[model samples]
Target: MKRSRAVSLGILGAAAFGLAACQTEEQTDAAAFSDEQSCVAAAAQSGWFTREDCAATFAEAKAVHEETAPRYESQALCEEEHGAGACGGDPAAASGGGGGSIFMPLLAGYLIGQALGGGRAMAQPVVPKAGGGFATPTGGTQLSRLNSTGKMGTTAFAKGPTTAGQPPMSRAAVASRGGFGGSAATRSVGS
Candidate 1:
């Protein structure tokens, strides 16, 4: 009985040891690339592999194409997954098949931002005037700012030197009821 108990304990210890070895997370991930998509995603996630790496390893893994080693989707998709100029196909031809150069979209986004003045370091804020006129903080280069009715009023005009003989063109100083209905002023250039 004593010998049998010892043998059973030894067997149990060996089984525990074997089970412990199976719980390791360091299992090899090298063969994790069962297909091109998974391999591309993994390699791209590492940020080390390029498009050539994808074509060479992934495409070659499955005998991708007869003409090409590993056929790629589109330049745009490839560039997105890899880097610029990473795709194997012609960029123009791939436009209908897949998106083209990624730079063009980025460039277009930059231009759109610039056109809306969103890219400016300091954008001019819309200032509220007493006569319901909206103007920039500095009143801009224009002599008069537009009012709510889309008409140029005298509420927020940039003040220049008053003419020696001519009267002021803006009625901004004139006090009116309900903040509207002020007399129109004629703006004049150099006399």
Candidate 2:
């Protein structure tokens, strides 16, 4: 019973942390993606593209550049004058921008958690298994907690006489009479 109670508390604490983490992730994503769609839409709204003009420009530029120089000579001169970027035109240094350092630790943590089974679980209760295993507490269930009462709880499964399908708790108030868990806490009509 004590272990179950501790498990309940732990589940409650985990749930609180989960809620906080979810809220933080949502806020971070919102901040990061802000105005992204608007910027894409604005860029796409520029209706200045003509396929014929694009083709003509490409052909004219290609003819002029090719006619002006020998390809191998131009390549050798480019490599001598500038660097390898003259060939590919795109490199890590050229694509550099203002961004924080990569969080390798965070990636490692995520991978470790995934390896340790941090995802959704299978169906199982957090109690002594009927066959002799143990129940893993997923979260605290309010139905498991007794309302201020001594009764076995309406949520309790049917023993010998108690019916299985009952309400959350017995209607008879046990707190007022100052008795709990099947103690003598009777009530009269007037009081």
Candidate 3:
């Protein structure tokens, strides 16, 4: 049946979405790992110690590094540019702008995606309905509807349009169905 096909489509779409979500998560993890590695490399180059030095210091390098961040700009810059230096080098090396290497970009992308949508799903739409009642396919949103905002010139949100081949409507009817005109900020179907 056509309804069955619709159901299948919905299921397939959801599975695909779930897979894509997993991929994005994997990418995020990879990004974080990359940052940690880069930080290690840079730290070695700047001194204030190394894997071997940490062994001598105590054997746990990560803990030492966290406590050894520089407190001065000149010291941080020196270590950053010239490679690892003495533990007493500078006070600012640890600051490193709160230490962003590669993970920040991936994390930022994920946050933006969540903000654009995702917090609210399976809700009603903002557009008038052709069936004289609110009806929208679950998880059916246009790329533009979700992503056409942000730095782009498009608006952050838009009222979706009704599908073609339906009946005419009265202004009052359209207005009433949306639960608007009451000033209570009704949450519409397509919203």
Top lDDT hit: 1
For each of the candidates, the C-alpha root-mean-square deviation to the true structure, in angstroms, is: 34.8, 32.2, 24.7
Computed on alpha carbons, the lDDT of every model, listed in order, comes to 0.23, 0.19, 0.21
Instruction: State the lDDT of candidate 2 residue by residue for 58-104, as single tens digits.
Output: 34323322222111112333232223333221122224442321110
Could you tell me the TM-score of candidate 2?
A: 0.18
- Please report the candidate that would top TM-score against the real structure: 2
By summed lDDT, the worst window of 10 consecutive residues in model 3 runs over 102-111
Runs with alpha carbons beyond 4 Å of true place in candidate 3 = 1-162, 179-191
Return the clash pairs for model 2, or none: 126-135, 127-135, 150-180, 150-181
lDDT of 1 by residue, 73-125 (tens): 33343233223543344333335354332211110000000112222211112
Worst 10 residues of 1 by lDDT: 104-113
Q: If the candidates were sorted by their TM-score against the true structure, best first, what order would they fall in?
A: 2, 1, 3
Task: State every prediction's TM-score relative to the real structure.
Answer: 0.17, 0.18, 0.15
Q: What clash count does candidate 1 reach?
A: 0
Q: Measured by C-alpha RMSD in angstroms, how accurate is candidate 2?
A: 32.2
What order do candidates take by lDDT, descending? 1, 3, 2
lDDT, candidate 3, 79-191, per-residue tens: 23223442132222224444422110001010011112323211112111121211111112212121111221011122223311222223343345442112222223223
